[model samples]
Target: MGKPTGFMEYERSVSHAEKPKERIKHFNEFHQPLSMEERKCQGARCMECGVPFCQSGIIIGGMASGCPINNLIPEWNDSIYRGNMKQALSRLMKTNNFPEFTGRVCPAPCEAACTCSLNGDAVAIKENELTIIEHAYEEGYFKPNPPKVRTGKKIAIIGSGPAGLSAADQLNKRGHSVTVYERSDRLGGLLMYGIPNMKLEKQIIKRRINIMKEEGITFVTKADIGGNYNAEEIMKSYDSVILACGASNPRDIKVPGREAKGIHFAVDYLKATTKDILDRNKTLTPDFKNFTITAKGKKVLVIGGGDTGNDCVGTAIRQGAISVVQLEMMPKLPDQRADNNPWPEWPKVAKTDYGQEEAISLYGEDPRVYQTTVREFIADEQGNVCKAKIVRLESKFNEESKRFMMEEIAGSEYEIEVDMVLIAAGFLGAQSYVADAFGVELDVRTNVKTDAGNYQTNVDNVFVAGDMHRGQSLVVWAIREGREAAKAVDTHIMGYSNL
Candidate 1:
């Protein structure tokens, strides 16, 4: 441990964020980093338990309980406390290939599973990590290290997202020639589009990508293997192919009037908006007429109550939406941790995400409408959605049937006028076209079929990882899969592996 009495001497202090009203006016990061002294104090709060459940990365109740990459949290905390930032960064990079991304976007399960959290407070591992990497960058500690020798083995990675990038980093480090292909014009997949700029800036992603490029990894953007380029042809050329395309197949609401022009998938909407931003910055064009979806002066109703839904809410608020309402199928959670949820576990409680804070500040009330679902959409003559009919639902467990069901409450039907509807119900699985093109088998959930121990697909030379193989999951989990898949590929190629 850094200090025997460090946990008791220093209290937890998290980074401060800008007020919602001020932050929503611009598309930039709102959370400000804590000072050097504050970060050291936060790192000192680490008890460094013998078990260290914060780095366990185990599954409990079908959800991730700690850091999925199993980062060396305690060691790094001690390093930071000793003012050894280079060693701290080295320890962090041992597991997580991209600390900068996770530090900003990850929910920090490590904090929730911390030993200190047993008393309702956790060590600020996330902030400490961000501080270490940012300090390393400023001190000129991070530099590109290309492989000393080439293995003459070529590998192709699809998607260029977190998973693919992680795999490329690992395989290239092992002396393999790695090439990452991305369908979009830019790399970083969801990091480039799905997530908003206010949460994770694009420049941060580009900075890391540049380092990876200097490390002898090739990035080919605007290259769609199953589309303009033949998947079979690419597979034939490369020694191995790793699919990390992610779960791109979005779940859609199949209700009446869904074909209306105003209805759109959340991913499509976010992608279009970010693409416009990038293109406009490149071309110096002032015209935004081609960007079809805009929330300006419109009543926006977001269907779903997850992170993506919150993203829609925040994006709409930034776009100057006249009003916003977020609908959730489940009831609201308690503000405090329930009795059944004990210490050292992620608390099942209600909290305001960034978007809800913005909405509440502007409207004087929270925008989330719990225990409600859309019954039908009412559209105008132009085939555009104008209003939504909703009904309250009551959830109950049927003892006889041994299952839970939702029943619409009587006389609880209500209507709200809305000019736009964003369906943020989340993804189902990976797109079918790529899997079909490669003739890969899929599980019942539509994810690529791979054994638990081995990430290899039915084809000998093909492997799968990330959401494409494991379903929609955390970015850290994707990075883990990518690293492991690279190991499996290296073993297959050289009859020995060092991953």
Candidate 2:
């Protein structure tokens, strides 16, 4: 370690965020990163523990503990403390290909598993990573370095999300010709559309895509493999096919007025807003006529209390929503870790994210209604949603069922006026159309079925990874899956993988 007593001398510090009330007026990212010198002190706070659980990537209590990519945390921290910015960037790129994406949006399982977090605040690992990568970009350390040689093997990836991009990056580095196909108008499937612009700006994605283009990777936008394009022909042309198409089939809530005019899936709502933002930026016109699912001047009701729901709250607020409320069937998590959730496991605690904070600042209370669910939707004569019948729920262990069950509390039903409903209750798995078109079998949960130890499907040369294979998951996991799947495809084509 560069400084043995640095952890004792320094305290954890992170980025400064724009105030909630001010930031809610726009859809831009709110975080302002710390300066280089202050970030170096944060790097010095890494205690360099003997085990260094921050890089373990272990599953404790059925949740991921650390960096799924198994980053070399201590090495990079030491490099940063010694003022070796280039070396730190090199070490960072060794494990994770897209630090810019994960540093901004990842929930930071590494911090939860940090040795310092057992007693005090964890080392600012995520923020330090952001600083290192951004510094490398600013200092021109990142350049378009095409492979010196080509292996003559061509690969096609179905999706252009993090997993697909990571796989393409690794395979390209291994000197293989990689082509990424995206169905959207632009590149970056989920990163560009599913996530709100406030969390990750679209320019960051475009910058990386341009560099990849310079490195000889082909990106085909508006190319739908299963629907518009010929999926079978694509498979025959490429030596191997990796399906990184994310799990995008939203889990919808079935209620009385589900077919109402103003109800939409969360993904549709988010994608439309992002497209509108991008389109308006490109052209001088601020036209939004194409977007059907909007929250303007409406009392919006979001179902589910997850990250997606939070994003909806933020987006609705920006779209001029009159009021917003989120429903969650499960009880709220404790503010602090419980006795059962010990050190090194993901803390089972509450998190007040930027969206929730903004809602509180605007509405004078938190927007989340914990342990409540929508029972029915009331619509007007025009078939437009107008209100939601909500009910309080009690969770109890049912002995016969041998599982926790949600029971509606008696005399707890009530109604609230709402003009729009957005279902953000997470996703089930990949959409059936793509899997069906490829003739690939799916697991019971609707995720692509693959052997436990492999990324290949039952059909030869057809591979699946990321959320499509592992169900709805974090961005870091998607990157890890993409890297692993790229290696699998590389080995399947050639004798073995050098990725």
Candidate 3:
């Protein structure tokens, strides 16, 4: 309630994205933040309702309805409307430990559940949040303030992704010594490699890690907990251990010629490109004269149409891919939400993500082919994938299971040139090595198992969070899980928890 009629008076405005063609030229962040005044106006769009669904953080109709971390959206929006960046950030950090990362990569379920979306465009909650944090950084609001006292207790966090970082931050602030171990040569786990630079520049992650180091959190890299390091030794050393290693085991499609050399998991392919970018200190627009797994001049076929697949499409185009086709098992969704997908529920609609936009701009066609899948990979004399046999699929009701299932359509198989294939069919579960080494049990889905609504593992003094505890999910959800897991660990150690 900065202004009673603020919602009516101001129209929602968000940050502008660079032209697709121009942005694809560099592997860097493309969205330009709005000016302070403009962002303040956007903040004015918050209605501040009696029951603000924006922060409810509940599931409705089998989908997440609002901010999973329960951010105080209205309060921060009011702070912004009144030009109080400090207050805005203060309210923001109360719940979310890393607004900077969420503001960039999150899908913004808060906006989807906004009351304003019932009638008009939703408030630019994400950008307003980004503005608050970025402004805080530009100013001197962020400071490395270590805990004044130590609890004489030590904890080990396996993984340096969002979840592990947040958990380490919380426990360290609670006066407990925290150490995070990452198997990767660099820290941030997937943030360092799996994600492309254009979405989130690597420097931002470095900035946060540097501050955490100053705040008395220790990070160990190239430490493979289950393989190189002894899990039993770690259990003996730490008062408590938190496993935040994300679900890194990617699901693979079983098809003929799956062993072809040109076929790779999406995670590995993205990591290769990112590592090359970081090593070269610049975006190397590849000019591959021969097949080196880089997408230069390759006719690429991406399996699955999730965010990862879209990322592959974008990355390949930037690496000078001659052509790209994305296959989805499900059919394309409607441009607008259907009647079943009412407001306040997650809207089921087709979204053209940035990568697809780039592909369309350059290729003059959407690279995604819905309701189709790869039947086989056709390899050349050298046993490298040369083309893919695609088969169209149709949804049919199964009488026995009483569910819809996708079946291959008859006489719908076709072949197209494909020098590279990236499978982005989502993740199955956490890698079994870490859990096996620790003797942690796994659920039916292969996620680390625990009692429902609990973070404690079967073993004493061991806890789990993030993708390892749940499944592959957003960074925002991972942070929430880590914070919650920290609370459980703190309680077990101190006899009572105040996290």
Candidate 4:
């Protein structure tokens, strides 16, 4: 512990964000970092408990309670408080392959599981993490350090998302020749395209990719291993193969008029906008007319109450949507935690995110309508969606089935004007083509099947990790999966893993 009474001496302070209305004007990061002194004080607030649950990374009540990467939280907190950034950055990077990415986007389970949060506010772990990594970069501590000697073993990582990058990072550091293949035009699968730029700037992903390249990791873009190139060719060439392709097959809402022209999946909509941004910035004559999926002058309805739905709301607002409303089937959470939800468990409570905040600023009310769902999309004569048929829902326990069920309230159906609808419900699993090509078995949920609690697949010399193995999850979890998969692969190839 840096200071025994530091928790009492200082209060938790998070990074400041710009007003939602102002931030929605441009697709860029809106959070302003605190000064170095302020950030250090925030770090000093860490109590460094005897049993630090902040770094436990355990699952409580079916949700991740702490840092999944098991970051050395207390050690780094003390390091920051003592002005020892060298040690702080070292500790931060020890577990997480991408602190910068998590710092900006992760929900920070570490804070939820913080000891201080059991009573008062938690340590500003996420902001503090961002500060440490950014400080290290400014001080030139992130320079490339290629492996001293290369292992004869060659490895090919399919999919250049967080998992693939992390796996490649670990394997390369262990002296293996690593090459990552991405089907997309750029690397950082979801980080580059799925997530909007305002939440996480694309430059951050590119910066890290460049450093990895300099450090001897090879990256090949627009190379679809199972499609453009034969999967067998890669298996024959590399000593080992790891699949980190994320869960990208989105779940569809099968309400009436689902096949309407104006409806789209959230991933496709988000990707198009990012690609458009990249095209406009780099090209003299931007050819993004086909890439544009705009909500300009349109009344938009996004279905879902999760982070991706919120992102869709923000993107629509930025794109000049005339009005926006989001639909959530479940009822709104209480303002405070329920009795059953104790400390260290993820708090199930209502919180207005950036997108909703922006919507309220512009429209004078929260855009989320809870306990309701779309019954159907009313399409216009031109085959474009023009309205939505919504119905209110109530939950009741079914005594016969021992399950909670959504019951539509009688005479509660209503119609609202809408021009476009984006489905942000969530992903189902990885796409089928790649998994089929690799001949990998899939669990019932369509995720790549690995041995229980292991990353190795049924096929020899084949491994799977990240969303491909674990289903849709946080970026931190994906990074952890990648690191773990790399260790498994390393052991398989060298008969020992020093990763």
In candidate 1, stretches whose alpha carbon ends up further than 4 angstroms from where it belongs are 282-291, 398-401
lDDT of each model, Cα atoms only? 0.88, 0.91, 0.91, 0.91
Candidate 2, which segments miss by more than 4 Å at Cα? 282-292
Position 308, candidate 3: lDDT: 94
| Root-mean-square deviation of candidate 3 | 1.4
Model 3, 24-43: lDDT tens digits are: 87788998889999888888
lDDT of 1 by residue, 199-258 (tens): 888889999999999999999998887898799988988999999999999998988888
Model 3 lDDT at residue 93: 91
For all predicted structures, in order, the TM-scores are: 0.97, 0.98, 0.98, 0.97
**Residue pairs with clashing backbones, model 4:** none
Error of 4 at 328 (Å): 0.7
User: Candidate 3 — worst ten consecutive residues by lDDT sum?
Assistant: 284-293
Candidate 4 per-residue C-alpha lDDT over 1-499 given as tens digits, one digit per residue, 9 for 90 to 100? 7888889999888778898767776788898889888888988899989899999999998999999999999999999889999999889989998999999999999999999988889999988998898999999987788899998899999999999999999999999999999999989999999999998989999999999999999999999978998999999999999999999899999988988889999999999988988877732122223347988889999999999999999988888889999999999999988999998898888999999999999999899999999999988999999989999999999899999998899999999999999999999997899998888999999999987889988887889989999999999999999999999999999999877
**How many angstroms is residue 224 displaced in model 4 relative to the true structure, after the best TM-score fit?**
1.4
